[model samples]
Target: MSKKNSESDSANGVRLDKWLWAARFYKTRGLAKDAIEGGKVDYNGAKGKPSRMVELGALIGLRQGYDDKVVEVLGLNDQRRPATEAQALYQETPESIAARERKAADRKANNGALVSEHRPSKKERRQIHRFKSDVFSGESL
Candidate 1:
Protein backbone atom coordinates (compact mmCIF):
# COMPACT_ATOMS: atom_id res chain seq x y z
CA MET A 1 0.00 0.00 0.00
CA SER A 2 1.10 3.59 -0.57
CA LYS A 3 2.33 5.73 2.35
CA LYS A 4 -0.75 7.91 2.09
CA ASN A 5 -3.03 4.90 2.29
CA SER A 6 -1.09 3.48 5.25
CA GLU A 7 -1.22 6.78 7.09
CA SER A 8 -4.94 7.05 6.51
CA ASP A 9 -5.38 3.52 7.78
CA SER A 10 -2.97 3.87 10.68
CA ALA A 11 -3.78 2.09 13.90
CA ASN A 12 -2.67 5.01 16.04
CA GLY A 13 -6.03 6.68 15.38
CA VAL A 14 -7.11 10.35 15.37
CA ARG A 15 -8.51 12.57 18.08
CA LEU A 16 -12.18 11.89 18.71
CA ASP A 17 -13.25 15.50 18.42
CA LYS A 18 -11.23 16.15 15.28
CA TRP A 19 -12.53 13.00 13.62
CA LEU A 20 -16.11 13.83 14.60
CA TRP A 21 -15.83 17.31 13.15
CA ALA A 22 -14.13 16.06 10.00
CA ALA A 23 -16.77 13.41 9.61
CA ARG A 24 -19.44 16.16 9.76
CA PHE A 25 -21.05 14.76 12.86
CA TYR A 26 -20.65 18.23 14.40
CA LYS A 27 -20.45 21.61 12.71
CA THR A 28 -17.28 22.58 14.62
CA ARG A 29 -14.47 20.93 16.52
CA GLY A 30 -15.51 22.86 19.63
CA LEU A 31 -19.01 21.45 19.38
CA ALA A 32 -17.60 17.96 18.95
CA LYS A 33 -15.39 18.42 21.98
CA ASP A 34 -18.31 19.62 24.05
CA ALA A 35 -20.41 16.66 22.97
CA ILE A 36 -17.63 14.22 23.90
CA GLU A 37 -17.09 15.84 27.27
CA GLY A 38 -20.82 15.93 27.97
CA GLY A 39 -21.13 12.14 27.45
CA LYS A 40 -23.19 12.58 24.32
CA VAL A 41 -20.56 10.72 22.33
CA ASP A 42 -19.42 7.19 23.13
CA TYR A 43 -16.61 5.11 21.73
CA ASN A 44 -17.01 1.36 21.55
CA GLY A 45 -19.94 1.57 23.95
CA ALA A 46 -17.94 3.61 26.47
CA LYS A 47 -17.90 7.36 26.91
CA GLY A 48 -14.77 8.94 25.46
CA LYS A 49 -12.99 12.25 25.92
CA PRO A 50 -12.40 14.78 23.20
CA SER A 51 -8.71 13.87 22.99
CA ARG A 52 -9.38 10.16 22.86
CA MET A 53 -7.95 8.31 19.90
CA VAL A 54 -10.59 6.83 17.62
CA GLU A 55 -9.27 3.96 15.58
CA LEU A 56 -10.67 2.50 12.37
CA GLY A 57 -13.65 0.15 12.92
CA ALA A 58 -14.34 1.69 16.31
CA LEU A 59 -18.00 1.92 17.21
CA ILE A 60 -19.25 5.38 18.04
CA GLY A 61 -22.58 6.18 19.56
CA LEU A 62 -23.60 9.82 19.45
CA ARG A 63 -26.71 11.79 20.26
CA GLN A 64 -27.71 14.34 17.65
CA GLY A 65 -30.68 16.30 18.94
CA TYR A 66 -33.35 13.68 19.62
CA ASP A 67 -31.71 11.02 17.45
CA ASP A 68 -29.09 8.57 18.62
CA LYS A 69 -26.65 7.29 16.03
CA VAL A 70 -24.23 4.37 16.13
CA VAL A 71 -21.65 4.33 13.39
CA GLU A 72 -18.41 2.53 12.65
CA VAL A 73 -15.27 4.44 11.79
CA LEU A 74 -14.36 3.73 8.18
CA GLY A 75 -11.72 6.38 7.54
CA LEU A 76 -10.05 9.30 9.29
CA ASN A 77 -9.06 12.81 8.29
CA ASP A 78 -7.75 15.67 10.38
CA GLN A 79 -9.27 18.43 8.28
CA ARG A 80 -12.91 19.04 7.53
CA ARG A 81 -13.94 17.93 4.06
CA PRO A 82 -16.94 18.07 1.76
CA ALA A 83 -20.17 16.47 2.91
CA THR A 84 -19.84 13.49 0.59
CA GLU A 85 -16.24 12.89 1.61
CA ALA A 86 -17.10 13.28 5.28
CA GLN A 87 -19.93 10.80 4.95
CA ALA A 88 -17.43 8.22 3.74
CA LEU A 89 -15.57 8.45 7.05
CA TYR A 90 -18.24 6.58 8.96
CA GLN A 91 -20.83 3.89 8.29
CA GLU A 92 -24.02 4.00 10.32
CA THR A 93 -25.58 0.75 11.44
CA PRO A 94 -28.77 -0.20 9.67
CA GLU A 95 -30.64 -0.48 12.98
CA SER A 96 -29.60 3.01 13.98
CA ILE A 97 -30.66 4.42 10.63
CA ALA A 98 -34.04 2.73 10.85
CA ALA A 99 -34.61 3.92 14.39
CA ARG A 100 -33.73 7.50 13.50
CA GLU A 101 -36.10 7.48 10.53
CA ARG A 102 -38.87 6.00 12.66
CA LYS A 103 -38.36 8.60 15.36
CA ALA A 104 -38.42 11.43 12.84
CA ALA A 105 -41.66 10.14 11.38
CA ASP A 106 -43.19 9.93 14.85
CA ARG A 107 -42.08 13.44 15.68
CA LYS A 108 -43.59 14.75 12.43
CA ALA A 109 -46.89 13.07 13.15
CA ASN A 110 -47.01 14.36 16.73
CA ASN A 111 -46.09 17.88 15.66
CA GLY A 112 -49.06 18.03 13.32
CA ALA A 113 -51.39 17.47 16.28
CA LEU A 114 -49.94 20.41 18.25
CA VAL A 115 -49.81 22.98 15.42
CA SER A 116 -52.53 25.50 14.59
CA GLU A 117 -53.46 25.92 10.92
CA HIS A 118 -54.49 29.55 11.35
CA ARG A 119 -54.71 32.41 13.83
CA PRO A 120 -57.73 32.73 16.12
CA SER A 121 -60.70 34.73 14.75
CA LYS A 122 -61.28 38.36 15.83
CA LYS A 123 -64.10 37.32 18.21
CA GLU A 124 -61.83 34.68 19.76
CA ARG A 125 -59.11 37.27 20.31
CA ARG A 126 -61.60 39.61 21.96
CA GLN A 127 -62.74 36.82 24.28
CA ILE A 128 -59.12 36.05 25.21
CA HIS A 129 -58.50 39.74 26.01
CA ARG A 130 -61.67 39.89 28.12
CA PHE A 131 -60.66 36.76 30.04
CA LYS A 132 -57.18 38.18 30.72
CA SER A 133 -58.69 41.53 31.91
CA ASP A 134 -61.19 39.77 34.14
CA VAL A 135 -58.44 37.69 35.80
CA PHE A 136 -56.26 40.77 36.37
CA SER A 137 -59.25 42.74 37.74
CA GLY A 138 -60.03 39.98 40.27
CA GLU A 139 -63.40 39.26 38.60
CA SER A 140 -64.75 35.85 37.57
CA LEU A 141 -64.76 35.06 33.82
Candidate 2:
Protein backbone atom coordinates (compact mmCIF):
# COMPACT_ATOMS: atom_id res chain seq x y z
CA MET A 1 0.00 0.00 0.00
CA SER A 2 1.30 3.47 -0.86
CA LYS A 3 1.29 6.01 1.91
CA LYS A 4 0.48 9.62 1.21
CA ASN A 5 2.29 12.43 2.91
CA SER A 6 1.66 16.11 3.27
CA GLU A 7 3.18 18.46 0.67
CA SER A 8 5.62 19.93 3.16
CA ASP A 9 6.52 16.56 4.52
CA SER A 10 7.41 15.11 1.16
CA ALA A 11 10.65 15.85 -0.64
CA ASN A 12 8.76 17.51 -3.46
CA GLY A 13 10.07 21.05 -3.41
CA VAL A 14 12.72 21.74 -6.02
CA ARG A 15 14.41 24.48 -7.96
CA LEU A 16 12.15 26.49 -10.20
CA ASP A 17 13.97 25.50 -13.35
CA LYS A 18 13.84 21.85 -12.40
CA TRP A 19 10.13 22.04 -11.76
CA LEU A 20 9.55 23.79 -15.07
CA TRP A 21 11.50 21.19 -16.95
CA ALA A 22 9.92 18.31 -15.12
CA ALA A 23 6.51 19.75 -15.79
CA ARG A 24 7.33 19.73 -19.51
CA PHE A 25 6.84 23.47 -19.75
CA TYR A 26 10.35 23.74 -21.19
CA LYS A 27 12.20 21.22 -23.30
CA THR A 28 15.53 21.55 -21.54
CA ARG A 29 17.11 22.89 -18.42
CA GLY A 30 19.12 25.37 -20.45
CA LEU A 31 15.92 26.80 -21.87
CA ALA A 32 14.54 27.21 -18.39
CA LYS A 33 17.76 28.88 -17.27
CA ASP A 34 17.64 31.33 -20.15
CA ALA A 35 14.03 32.18 -19.46
CA ILE A 36 14.73 32.80 -15.80
CA GLU A 37 17.80 34.86 -16.56
CA GLY A 38 15.91 36.93 -19.11
CA GLY A 39 13.27 37.78 -16.52
CA LYS A 40 10.68 35.76 -18.34
CA VAL A 41 9.90 33.69 -15.24
CA ASP A 42 8.74 35.05 -11.93
CA TYR A 43 7.81 33.67 -8.50
CA ASN A 44 5.45 35.56 -6.30
CA GLY A 45 5.91 38.67 -8.45
CA ALA A 46 9.67 38.65 -7.89
CA LYS A 47 12.23 37.81 -10.55
CA GLY A 48 14.68 35.13 -9.52
CA LYS A 49 17.38 32.89 -10.84
CA PRO A 50 16.70 29.51 -12.35
CA SER A 51 17.96 27.82 -9.21
CA ARG A 52 15.36 29.38 -7.02
CA MET A 53 13.36 26.91 -4.98
CA VAL A 54 9.60 26.78 -5.31
CA GLU A 55 7.30 25.81 -2.49
CA LEU A 56 3.74 24.64 -2.48
CA GLY A 57 1.09 27.34 -3.13
CA ALA A 58 3.64 29.79 -4.59
CA LEU A 59 2.44 31.69 -7.61
CA ILE A 60 4.58 31.17 -10.70
CA GLY A 61 4.52 33.05 -13.96
CA LEU A 62 5.97 31.78 -17.19
CA ARG A 63 6.48 33.92 -20.27
CA GLN A 64 7.26 31.89 -23.33
CA GLY A 65 7.73 33.06 -26.93
CA TYR A 66 4.20 34.34 -27.42
CA ASP A 67 2.31 33.40 -24.26
CA ASP A 68 2.35 33.93 -20.55
CA LYS A 69 1.34 31.06 -18.28
CA VAL A 70 0.47 31.50 -14.65
CA VAL A 71 0.12 28.61 -12.27
CA GLU A 72 -0.03 27.88 -8.60
CA VAL A 73 2.57 25.42 -7.37
CA LEU A 74 0.75 22.27 -6.36
CA GLY A 75 3.58 19.78 -6.46
CA LEU A 76 7.13 19.28 -7.63
CA ASN A 77 9.05 16.34 -8.96
CA ASP A 78 12.43 15.56 -10.49
CA GLN A 79 11.12 13.83 -13.57
CA ARG A 80 9.73 15.24 -16.77
CA ARG A 81 6.15 14.43 -17.77
CA PRO A 82 4.11 14.19 -20.89
CA ALA A 83 2.55 17.37 -22.29
CA THR A 84 -0.87 16.51 -20.96
CA GLU A 85 0.15 15.14 -17.60
CA ALA A 86 2.59 17.95 -16.96
CA GLN A 87 -0.18 20.47 -17.32
CA ALA A 88 -1.90 19.12 -14.24
CA LEU A 89 0.82 20.18 -11.84
CA TYR A 90 -0.45 23.71 -11.56
CA GLN A 91 -3.75 25.52 -11.40
CA GLU A 92 -4.22 28.45 -13.77
CA THR A 93 -5.53 31.66 -12.37
CA PRO A 94 -8.47 33.60 -13.83
CA GLU A 95 -6.37 36.77 -14.05
CA SER A 96 -3.75 35.06 -16.18
CA ILE A 97 -6.45 33.67 -18.42
CA ALA A 98 -7.84 37.17 -19.00
CA ALA A 99 -4.38 38.65 -19.48
CA ARG A 100 -3.53 36.09 -22.13
CA GLU A 101 -6.76 36.78 -23.97
CA ARG A 102 -6.14 40.52 -24.00
CA LYS A 103 -2.61 40.04 -25.21
CA ALA A 104 -3.87 37.94 -28.08
CA ALA A 105 -6.31 40.66 -29.13
CA ASP A 106 -3.62 43.32 -28.96
CA ARG A 107 -1.22 41.25 -31.01
CA LYS A 108 -3.77 40.62 -33.75
CA ALA A 109 -4.57 44.31 -34.11
CA ASN A 110 -0.90 45.25 -34.24
CA ASN A 111 0.18 43.30 -37.33
CA GLY A 112 -0.55 39.84 -35.95
CA ALA A 113 2.74 39.90 -34.09
CA LEU A 114 4.50 41.33 -31.12
CA VAL A 115 7.06 43.89 -32.24
CA SER A 116 10.45 43.33 -30.67
CA GLU A 117 13.70 45.24 -30.82
CA HIS A 118 15.54 42.16 -31.93
CA ARG A 119 17.51 42.34 -35.16
CA PRO A 120 15.76 41.56 -38.40
CA SER A 121 15.81 38.03 -39.70
CA LYS A 122 17.43 37.06 -43.03
CA LYS A 123 14.04 36.93 -44.74
CA GLU A 124 13.27 40.45 -43.64
CA ARG A 125 16.57 41.64 -45.10
CA ARG A 126 15.74 40.01 -48.45
CA GLN A 127 12.34 41.70 -48.50
CA ILE A 128 13.95 45.05 -47.80
CA HIS A 129 16.34 44.57 -50.70
CA ARG A 130 13.52 43.65 -53.06
CA PHE A 131 11.40 46.60 -52.04
CA LYS A 132 14.30 49.01 -52.50
CA SER A 133 15.20 47.57 -55.90
CA ASP A 134 11.73 48.19 -57.34
CA VAL A 135 11.27 51.62 -55.73
CA PHE A 136 14.78 52.92 -56.56
CA SER A 137 14.81 51.60 -60.15
CA GLY A 138 14.21 54.00 -63.09
CA GLU A 139 10.58 52.85 -63.37
CA SER A 140 7.68 55.26 -63.79
CA LEU A 141 5.52 55.72 -60.76
- Superposed by TM-score, candidate 2 places the C-alpha of residue 113 at a distance from the truth, in angstroms, of 12
Supply every candidate's count of residue pairs whose N, Cα or C atoms clash at under 3 angstroms: 0, 0
**Candidate 1 Cα errors over 4 Å, as ranges:** 1-11, 116-141
- Each model's TM-score? 0.73, 0.68
lDDT of 2: 0.82
Q: Rate the local accuracy (lDDT) of all candidates.
A: 0.90, 0.82
How do the residues 3-24 of candidate 1 rate in per-residue lDDT, one tens digit apiece?
A: 6864764456788998999999
* Candidate 2 runs further than 4 Å off: 1-12, 112-141
Alpha carbon lDDT at 3, candidate 1: 65
lDDT of 2 by residue, 1-141 (tens): 133443443375678888889888889999988989999999999996787787889999988879898989877765676767777778889999999999998888897456667887999989989998988884765
Clash pairs, model 1 backbone: none
